[model samples]
Target: MSRRILVIDDEPGIRQALGQLLEYEGFEVKTASGGAEGISLYDSYRPQLVFLDVKMAGLDGLEVLKRLRQADPTATVVMISGHATIQTAVEATQLGAYDILEKPLDTDRVLVLLRNAFENRLLSEENARLRETIESRYEIVGRSFGIRALLERIDKVAATPARVLITGENGTGKELVARAIHRGSPRAKKPFVEVNCAAIPSELIESELFGHMKGSFTGAIADRPGRFEQADGGTLFLDEIGDMSASAQAKVLRVLQDGVVTRIGGSKPVQVDVRVLAATNKNLEDEIAAGRFREDLYYRLNVVPITVPALRERREDIPLLIVHFLQQLAARDGLPARGISEDALRRLQELEWQGNVRELRNTVERLVILASHATIGAPDVERLVGRRSAESPGLGGLLDIATFEEFKQAAERAYLLAKLRTFDWNVSETARALDMPRSNLYKKIERYALQRETVE
Candidate 1:
């Protein structure tokens, strides 16, 4: 494919020479005599690159550059000047000209500028495409009442620099909400740094969030910027914040207060401009009461609160989600596209999805891979992902769990629920049978949000 170039200069000799040279180099060339003609042709020609002269009769170079940039912010333009001053060059650059060339244009320099400009354009194009893919991947795809409400809150908070605290059960897509907030913010083009507070060890979490100087600790070989520094001028997402060590939480609170972070072994505090977004499956209010999480940090981070609904809470949107996941799988993973029967979708919705949307997506992926037919039916779903059972989530569900803590919690919840049912919801009997304290059992029930079916 040939790239287009436009030469806008009052000098006939310069225009003809550049146009001929560009033509010989396999470029589609267009020549304009003056700035007025150049601006007029810009709309029609739509050339990828433009070379405009500084000295023009009607419209000046800076004005033309500004107008061109206004017409298309992505315009690639270079200024050609016979007698140029530093201020003139600076002004051209500020007006969005790609580069400034002296009157006697060097063939080598012009070609080099074109190469560089086109290369940068390609990079910008690729970045735009990647951003689109990322946005689509992290899209919140539900129209359910719960989802609509959640999205409404997200929209209300997204445009502000206010800190957000996202709360939800495991696999409920809290990260999606955080990403959505970042995407909608003024800092959308900036970095969105994430740190799984629960994943890092207690011994190293402070250093991880605040950076470490060389030889600060046993394994600290070189100076490294932490999550706070890396996310400066962007967003910092602290996932599973309830699991963060208390010491680290205090440091985080200080950072939020002063916007300054000191390295592990460094005294100097580096200032940062970051919008912090924190998420946790655990009830942070409970965590604070239990002294497991810091109250000060919670207040700082919870300027805006967003709770993502569990999948079961919005079962009506299950079909829409199935369709979305199918399309996503096909586009992103190159998986075979398959349809789900109404019965199958309904069956899926009926199940108690303890693992939330994450669990459903996994189940969908399994069906796409293992189901025999082109379209998935209820029988296939039952055989593959089991039936619509509310009380019992099979051993497969435990095996599907990714994190050890989550597995332990799920196992404990299922065990406790079963024991309570066996005792006919007699708390005393279940507590006695499990050889656990009644108060402890009650606390567990509250933690898991477990309840009995009410007889209507």
Candidate 2:
């Protein structure tokens, strides 16, 4: 499809000429006489780009730009004016106009401006898409007290250049928290380099942290920069830091202390400005006690410690996470958005997500793609959770085995049995369990067709 452009000017000649020029440039163009008509056309056409006259009858270009921005924050608006003034240009810019064009229009300049504007618009949309991908990929969606507190801490820590150590179980979103911190920081525009200490070979760890020159080692085919050099002026996220060898830990400590790195086979140390963020599932203090990790380096990296709560600790957030994952999956698959049935959602909430956010996201994605109906019900959840059970041997699978009706019956039976056992088989215990002032548990005992068995 051709790119759409809308032109709004009081002068008919200017509008016609510009529209023709743009159309010749292979753009689909539309023209409006003034601000009112321009807004109406904008609403109807939803052009990718707009050109507006600065001076108009009812509403000026700046006001039009403001209105357009209000309607669509991402809409690109370019301002045109024959009687250009510094004040008018400034006002247009303040209102978020893409650029100011002075008339009689310079065809070459106009073409250049339009090309640049379109390219920038593409870049802007791409950036938004990338951010969205990152956000969804991170998959930390929730509004519970625990989630809110964690977000608040992330916001506060992101504003500073503090060395942070995030400790959590595997799959608890420590890396996600790290990325969120980097995205919210001043260095967001710069690179965010990640190094997994456990994944890299111990022998190559030094070269990985600090780049190697040509022929630096047996496999040194060419010069390459390390994570520290690449992450200069940004963030270097060292995941599984506890797995790093003692030699690598010492080198990391030096970088943190001196803010400099020396590449292998290179004489001079290169200065680098980088914020360090490290995460690990292991207890670093234990590693230090066991003589596997350096206490000094641990203290340096642990200036600010953040612990991500596991899913089990914040069960209230499970429903919100389910919806977030489904929406994200639907967007990715180009399908109409769908919702989970209340029964399914309730079952999900009861699950102890040992794998935390990562596991929950995977399960939701699976259900969204594989589920046959528009709304996932309890049966679908049972199937998904049941599949997981076959893979792992534990109580994790047991809870998912009970059908909806079976679960309801089991809950009722357990309530009555607990009351009978607690009160030494008193009828009052049954009544209390049934939430009745009198004849409560007895009525439930009769309603559920309860039977008594003597203790051995």
Candidate 3:
């Protein structure tokens, strides 16, 4: 499809020349004699780019630009005028003009400017889409009292410049809470950088946090800015901060105290204005007692503490979370909408999710992909959770049995379930691997009530 270009100029000669030139270059061009007609055409045509004369007879170029921008904030308008002063150019720019072209315009310069302007617009649109996707991915979904209270705390903490320390069990969405605070803060438009302390090796964590100059370390090919510098005038999230080495902890403490970060191999301290939001699944108090984490750093980061409640603590929200996750997954994967029976949802709510919201979402996605029926039922839930239960350590491991028959039965059950999962419930393949007939394996699976999921 050809790009649409609109030329809004009072001079018929200039308009006709540009229109012909743009049309020859494969752009769909529209011309307007004055600002009033230009604005009307803009509303109707919705062109990708606009070239407007600054000094027009009717509505001035700046006024039209403002009106167009107010109608569509993403409008890309370039101002052109034969009598353009520095002050006039500045005013046009302040009114959101994309560029100011002096009149008797060079065709070469106009084409080059159009190319750059369109490229920038494309990049901006892509970034906006990505930002929306990220926000949706990290959306906090719940309506329970615990969730309400957490949201209230987030609102209060986000308005301040206090350092936040979010504590929660693994998979409880600590990072999501941290992002919510960052999005709510005054620095929402600025960078929101994150570092996972546990993922990086202890030896390289210092360089990762404080950066390093070229040749400072083995892999340092160029001077690099750390998370603090990258998140300048914004929010820096330190996830799994409890896993940070003691040396790194001390450096973090120093930065928190003075708002300055000195690179690993550099003497100069670079000043940074960053709000720190830290999260950890570990008990920092216990870590401090064990001499693992720094006491001063703990005190500094704990200025505004938040604890994300476990999934089981808010069972009422499980259904809502499930619906949210399922909808998001369906939309993202281009899959048909899936539903869960009331009994199935209730069964989910009854279980204790040690892994919390993350686990529930994963489970929902799995069901969406693997369920045979459009509406997931209790039996489906049972089969799915049963497979997971067999994998987890349970009372069978701790219980002592007196008879050989009891022990043999339990071992056989566990063995058969593991084999079935390995084969993904392919009866023939599992039977072959187990050195048994397919019929016998089926009988055993039925006797044990073992369920296998089918993945498409």
- Who wins the lDDT comparison? 1
Return the top candidate by TM-score. 1
Give the alpha-carbon lDDT of every model: 0.86, 0.83, 0.86
If the candidates were sorted by their lDDT against the true structure, best first, what order would they fall in? 1, 3, 2
Q: What is the descending TM-score order? A: 1, 3, 2
- With a 3 Å backbone cut-off (N, CA, C), the pairs that clash in candidate 2 are 430-441, 431-440, 431-441
Per-residue alpha-carbon lDDT of candidate 3 for residues 1-456, written as tens digits (9 for 90 to 100): 238999999999999999998988889999999989999999999999999999899799999999999999999999999999999989988888999998898999999998998899889988998888889999999887668778888888898999998987789999999999999999999999999999999999999889998888788999998888999999999999999999999999999989999998898999999999999987687689889999989889988778787675577999999889888988777766899889988888876675778888888988888888999888888887753332333433313434676567656866887788788778999999978989999888755545443222
RMSD for each model, in Å, please? 8.7, 12.5, 15.3
The C-alpha stretches of model 1 lying farther than 4 A from their native spots are: 337-347, 373-380, 391-456
lDDT (Cα) of model 1: 0.86
Q: Report the error of model 3 at residue 2, Å.
A: 9.2
Off by over 4 Å in 2: 1-16, 19-116, 333-338, 369-374, 387-456
lDDT of 2 at 259: 91
